[model samples]
Target: MSSAVATVPGAEHAGVSLLRGDGVITSYTPSSSTVSEVDRLQSTYREGPCVTALWDQHTVVVDDLVAEADRWPRFAPEAAARGILSMLSFQLFTRDDSLGALNLYSSVRKRFDLDSQMLGGLFASQAALVLAGAQESVRLHRALATRDVIGQAKGILIERFGVDAETAFTMLVHSSQNTNLKLVDVARWLVQGRDRPVSS
Candidate 1:
C-alpha cells in the first residue's frame, strides 16, 4: 500500500487503510502523526471523503475541506481544524466488495487538480491489486487457524464425552446454533474452557 501510493505525482502525505464492513478501520499505514490523526478522525466520526468513498464505492474528491461544509458537515470542519485543506479518496477494489480506501491529504486548498486526480486514479488501481493480495492472505490465515481450533475442540469433546468425531462436531454445531455465535467462537470457547485450571 505504501509503495503503491508513493509513486503518485504530488501526493505529499498519503495513507492507506483497510476498513471493515461496519466502517471500522482494521489496518492502516501511519505515514505521519498528522495524517494518522486525520484518518482516525474520519473513522471515529464515521464521516470523511474516505468514508464517503467507501460507502458510495467511488472516488471522492474534496478540493477544499473548508469549502465542502455541505458535503461533510462534521468532518469538513474538523479536518480543516487539523490543517487538512484538501483530500482525495479512492475506493480500493470494486464496489461489490470494496476493501477500503487510499487517501491523499494536502495542507493547501485545491491541491489535487485534474492531473493529480488522473495520477491518483492510476495509483489507486495499483493499490487495489496489492490490497486484494493482502486481504486474501489474511483470509487464508484465519481459515487455517479456525480449522485448527475446531479440530482441537472436537478432540476435546471426543475425549471428555467419549463421543465419535461426527457426534462431537454435531454437539459443537448445536452449541453454536443455540448461542447464536459463529462456529469459530464456539470452538474457541470450548478450547479455552478445556485449558482452564480445574477447581477442586
Candidate 2:
C-alpha cells in the first residue's frame, strides 16, 4: 500500500528531512549539505516551502520563482542568490503528528503543477512511514531522558517529603497523569529551580 503511494519519483530528486525531538531537522535522505543550508536560510527568513510545509502540514509548491516576486520577496531573492529558482515541499505528517518535510528544488520556474502536487502528496505519505519509525526512536530516547529526570526529581522528593524512591516516583507519575502532562514535563517543572544545568 505504501509502495503504491510512493510511486512518484521524489526519492530521485527530493530531499526528505526528519525532525529531531528538539524540533530541528536532524537528518535528510538526499545527504545534500546544500539542502540543509537552503533550509537554514529559509528558516532564518521565515519563508519558502520549508516553513510553509512545517506550518501548513501539507505540500507547498513554488511553481514560478522569478514570476512570483509579490508572494515571497525575502525568500525568492535568497533562493535566486543561491541559484535556486523553483521549489516544492511536502510535509510528512499523520492526523496529529508532524515529522518533517520532503523538499524538492529546481533551477527554473513553472517546473511543477497540480499533477506534481498529487505525486508529491504520494511521496510524502511514503516518507511518513519512515518518519513514524523515526518517531519510535525519538520516543525511546525521550523515555530514557525522562527516566533520568524522574530519578533526579525523585531524589529531591525523597529528601523533601521523607518518602522512598517508589513513593516519590508514584507521586510524580500520578501528578503527571492527573494534569494530562508528560512525565518529562512534570519532572522538568520540579527540577527547574535546581542548580543543576540542563543539556538543552
RMSD of each: 3.8, 7.0
Error of 2 at 59 (Å): 2.2
lDDT of 1 by residue, 1-200 (tens): 45534666556678876676655764477577777888888878878888888778578878889988887788889989988998888888643444678898888888888888888998888878877888789889999999999999889888988889999898889888887889888899889885642111
| TM-score of each candidate structure, all chains considered together | 0.81, 0.62
Query: With candidate 1 superimposed using the best TM-score fit, by how many Å does residue 119's alpha carbon deviate from the native?
Result: 1.8
Give lDDT per model, in order: 0.79, 0.68
Considering summed lDDT, which 10 consecutive residues are worst modelled in model 2? 1-10
Q: Please write out the lDDT profile of model 2 over residues 8-84, one tens digit for every residue.
A: 43322457655444555543655456666777666567667777787765877776666656767787777777767
